[model samples]
Target: MRPIGLLTAAALSFLTSVALAAEGKEGMPQLDFKNVLLKSQIVWLVIIFVVLYILLSRWALPKVGAVLEKRAATIAGDLDAARQAKGAADAAVAELTAKTREAHAGAQAEIAGAVDAAKAAAAAQTATLTARLDAQLAEAEGRINAARAAAMGALRQVASDTAGVVVSRLTGVAANAAAVDAAVGSALSARGLG
Candidate 1:
């Protein structure tokens, strides 16, 4: 099949020349119905018009329509792709948000657990230290009591020796040991020291 565009271009050029010739011939010949060539010109006009219309409708117009349809389909495909991409991006963003929240929660849980463990360890250490200090205090108190007992025993011996010397010097005779010890014991008991 011949290209309709080329045929149409040729037809337009021929029609322009015919129109110019008709003007040169003093008037529009195609409109003059009384002329011998008027019938032939009208028949030729009808034939050209029908042929042009058929060529445009069957070949040229269908090709243009197909091109338009193809362009529309391409645009639709691009739009669909863009929408799908947007959906995927949205899903990815939501997933990332969820994961971030989960991770944050997990970290918080870990921190709480660590704090609890640290608190437990501190309590255990405190208990152990308190027990150790209490034991040391008891041992120190026992030592102090023992020292006090030893000092008191030594004080009694010293007092007895001093009493003997004082008695000999005052009476000019040796004091009896049993009588001196009895006097010291009575003196200590009266003073609430025995």
Candidate 2:
């Protein structure tokens, strides 16, 4: 009961007790057998308690239980949905990670191929340059050999002319060109110059 209503009832009961005491009563009136309303009050209290019990059991309690059950079902469904979403997210992350690794491997392969190609190209270029240099060296050696041969021929002619001039000037006799040439050839052969 409300506090105000309980307090009012208490006050009324006190006033009744005080009135009874003023009338020379020996004990409380509600407990007294002389009170005529006591039986009726007990009957009404029983009827009201039974009615409240029947209402709570048949209608109000069941509605409250149904509301609680519905709330629990909703919470359980939400939890299941959350778990499914989390699992999907995890799977997507794993797929993404796999794809990333695959792409990285492909890139590495491409880089390795490019490096190999560059090395091959560099080797080919070096071989071509080496071959060209060898050819040029051979040509230079041939030219040097030809020039040396021409220089030897000119030096032999000059030596023979000088010997003939010396013999005619010193001995007063002209030397034969053929003999001078033969002598100079002999001298050069002995010195290992020819």
Candidate 3:
């Protein structure tokens, strides 16, 4: 397959060359350097080449260079701006993290202070309540002692009066000094107050 393709290409190339030669413009006018040397085709071709080179160097090359420099500068500026933006973002993140840490510390400190204050307040309240309860208990005890003393005195007086009445009835006589004395003595002895 490859050999056939190569043979076909060679045949086509040979045919194209023969056709071009048959149609060649061979009778064109020739420039004679002996009469007009500077106006020759070779001289004109050199002039055109020089003019194109001058125009490209003076106008086209500078414009192209300026455009490339401007593009390069714009690219560099964009990269620098991107770098600055990234740095700013990093700084902002650091600042935010620092602020968060500070806030956490402040909150923890405040919570600790509040807890301490609450504990102190509770302790003070507990002390006050204990003191108040103690005072109340003491007062209650004093009142109970006074009531018991009064009740005992009243019972003793009632017993003495009853004994006097009984003695008078058993003796079948009026109330006398001896009977009274005996009754008082008996009452005192019964109450262990003698």
Candidate 4:
């Protein structure tokens, strides 16, 4: 017998002794030692306890243990899946970060290239404008010099005419055109006007 059977037997013996002591004295028929059915009741109680324990050990307890084991396995599987997902997520995040940095660098390079191109275009335009302006300025200077030369030639002719008119009026004789021109030329050369 198991420990539980020993205990049940000991309990049953003590109850029987008590019932015998209180047999004819106690008014409770349930405890009466003269009642032979009490022994059969004790035997039935022991049989019921043993059968119930066997049923629980063979069927119910094993089912409960299987359920617990399945639950533990499921929890472990879920944890492993979560860890794998976290690792994949971390790798994706790292890749995204690297791509982001690469895209930023590419954008920066493109921006710098655009800036350089713009600056070069502007410089070229400035040089072209400068050259055009210089040409225009030089043309203007040449026009001014031409106009001054023409004006000076007209002034020399007028001076010669005036000198011839003065010479004819003072000497009462017609002045020579060749002599007037030579005199004006000499005067103009001396004054640095020729």
Candidate 3: which stretches are off by over 4 Å?
A: 1-39, 117-194
Provide TM-scores for the models. 0.47, 0.50, 0.43, 0.45
Q: What's the lDDT for all of these models?
A: 0.89, 0.92, 0.82, 0.93
**Candidate 2 residue pairs in backbone clash:** none
Best-to-worst order by lDDT is 4, 2, 1, 3
Pairs that collide in candidate 1 are none
List, residue by residue over 1-194, the lDDT tens digit for candidate 1.
46798899878867886888778853455557788787887799999999999999999999999999999999999999999999999999999999999999999999999999999999999999999999999999999988977876787778888999999999989999999988988887788776
Runs with alpha carbons beyond 4 Å of true place in candidate 4: 1-101
Task: Determine which window of 10 residues in candidate 2 has minimal summed lDDT.
Answer: 26-35
- Candidate 3 achieves a global lDDT of 0.82
User: Whose TM-score is greatest here?
Assistant: 2
All candidates in order of TM-score, best leading: 2, 1, 4, 3
Q: Roughly what TM-score does model 4 have, to 2 decimal places?
A: 0.45
* Predicted structure 1, TM vs. truth: 0.47
Candidate 4 CA-lDDT value = 0.93
- For residue 39, model 3's alpha carbon misses the true position, in angstroms, by 9.4
Relative to the unseen true structure, what is the Cα RMSD of model 4?
Answer: 10.4
Of candidate 3, the 10-residue stretch with the lowest lDDT total is 25-34
